[model samples]
Target: MNMDNRRYNVNARSLPVSNALHGSSTVISELEPLHRRSDVVLNEQGLPRHSGCTRLKKLVHKSKIRFGTWNVGTLNCKSVEVVGVMIQRKINILCLQETKWRGEEAKDIQGFKLWYTGKVSARNGVGIIIDKEWKRNVVEVSRIGDRIIFLKMIIGRETVNIVSAYAPQVGIEASLKELFWEDLEGLIRHIPQNEKIFIGGDFNGHVGREAGQYARVHGGFGFGELNNEGQTLVDFSLAYDFKIANTCFKKRDEHLITYKSGASRSQIDFLLVRNTDRRLCKNCKVIPGDAVTTQHRVLVLDVCIMSKIQKRRQVVTPRIRWWQLKGEKQDIFKRNLLDKGIWESQGSANIIWEDMAKKIWEVAKVVLGESKGLVREIRSLGGGIIVYRTKSSIRRTVLKPYICVTMRKIGRGTVWLRKKLRELWVKLVLKLLKNFIRTLRRRKESKIFIRLPRVGKENQEI
Candidate 1:
């Protein structure tokens, strides 16, 4: 085999005097077919594993942040369950309206922290709930009456400002509506231009389906016709160059509607962000099967997070299988160290320790083998559907748009095939879920038994 031999050079000036104590004279050359570093990593089962910094860069450059907005009518007794719903949806930040939480201070609900603003009674109120992971980054909190509350957080290298608001109803006095807008205007003006901001709440308006001249703010995807309240929101968005996140994505009417009761359906709850950051949004749809039990459906916004400072992610070093070093391998390791001329060098105690450590690692790696990479299992669910499950990245369904279009063109045959494929996918997901639950239960039971003995004998049950 044609081989490419490589060698790493060590600095001579840094060498110490103690290296003469323990020594070797072997010259190590990495050969392509022998001891060369392979770009393709393999696991114990001989399967290929993903290596390098590509995955790490993807993880650090863009993070998925989910924002949910819902008008719970009142957060009086359902704070715990509502937080649970947020957790279930994997929401990082939640903005609530009509909370009826009569307080101007922040309160802890379960593990999340809630910052709310309201008057004396349970009337109009707005609140912002931050996930426990990001709560420590909070730098400032602003509570402005019962209609608006703003929070600023230092996330990574960027500053994020979140505002929760509850606008006056459609039939409310014109003066109150005007006052609401005026207050919101002041709040917007006070925010720094360099910081990222997101405002979410029950706006009680619809931007309509026609973009017309408002295409800068609305993406021509909306439910219901435009009303006076909606016109006000659109005008504000146009003036500030902010995009309505819900209107930016094209989804079915079911996903667009945020409030539904009997025959009445409307898109009122909204999430707004700067137009420049609109491209970072992946999906903004209403959660249909929300268990919050409220008139307003939960509007979830999936936005790709960006950090101003680029930090290098730490790579995990594989563990060396030292147990495999026996017989000929152990002799080879000793001989290679002796050949490296480690003892012949003149070095101090610290330098000797460093040289010996390096020589041992290199000799062992060459004598034995480099650590094996992780092997990931690929699952196939009949009908050409495949899924690659791994801890390095989220499990994504493998689908090609071109293939789907081609399948649809084959008439009824394609339709039948698609139906069968969907059925198989569902079944596979359910099976995986069952197995995951079983594993979790086993772990929980094991923990219980382990702690049971630690407790007093009188307190422990059989």
Candidate 2:
């Protein structure tokens, strides 16, 4: 028989690690084929068993960082007891706004680890909440002149950094943009190239590419404030390439909403990071906390999940009796064959072609590889895989774009940095006042409450 041997190419980055590991773990489930293929991955028994990192260790350890950001209708943290309740449930990164506290005042809370960076405005407080385990990644914390405090947290084994910020609303007309960007510019500049950064918090702006109004699953309405920020926020995001993470839709089949206020309600809450880290965002979700005290909603997200792949496999034929086959009715094998083009009707192909199964196996293998290539796309960008149980770069290939940010128009819109940043505090103070007025007008018209589950409700699964 004439043989045509071909070399198979494996892109180091695009290798289906998730699927390969899955296949290895599923050794017992491997089905033997009518024709055998040559490959060392097979075992003495002709069954493919897994080995080491090749065999992905399947696990269900919930490493979810239940994080969210909210404007907190008022400066009253005490009113948002539901937030604390949500924390007890599962909270890793919790950002609050309208905190109305100085940095010293925030220090009094015990047990619960907290970091607060406040602006001169009455309610421009922003901070990051992390479990004791992740808090160690905090390389530095800088206070933004009592207006806002910025924290840079290093993501586990990633070149990407996390920035938690609360921008001031009040500032002078001349240098407003310059002052804010100056503070932000330094944090990103310090991080090494090829490292990504997810700067999320109440920037009070929706700076993302994907477009959709703030939507809530319940009652044909949205949560919080959804007023379009226009280009002010968009321009800044474009200049710096900060992707808004709110593009992911909430799974509210029936009705699930987080916040409500006035005639028009919207979801201003966020759980954002750079869109470049889309791969790292294993499973992003927005969950509401059952809290009655505050007007803002809660957001939940899961990060860092591997992908799934299904590999085409070939093995020797299972236990079969050639003598029994000889005794069987001639039509029996033909009747048992799958009718979905399993066997070619033309091209001189027949049920007794003996090698027909081998041809089918070859087709299936090619089809499987083509299908898997779609699921496994990380190789398109320059990404690498690190060997497990060791700190070594094992495989490298093109993966998706990492966090490579390029900023423009350093002194475009806001106040210039040449002047004192504190002088621009007027802008934030005015913004706080406007927000307070907006809140008062809305509260007078409606009553807000958290969603408490009723036992009699239909199909109520948590």
Best by TM-score: 1
> Model 1: per-residue lDDT, tens digit, 283-355?
9999888767647888999988786545444343454557667798788877888999768656798888898
Q: Which candidate number would show the highest lDDT if scored against the true structure?
A: 1
In candidate 2, position 147 carries an lDDT of 38
TM-scores of the candidates are 0.56, 0.45
The TM-score measured for candidate 1 stands at: 0.56
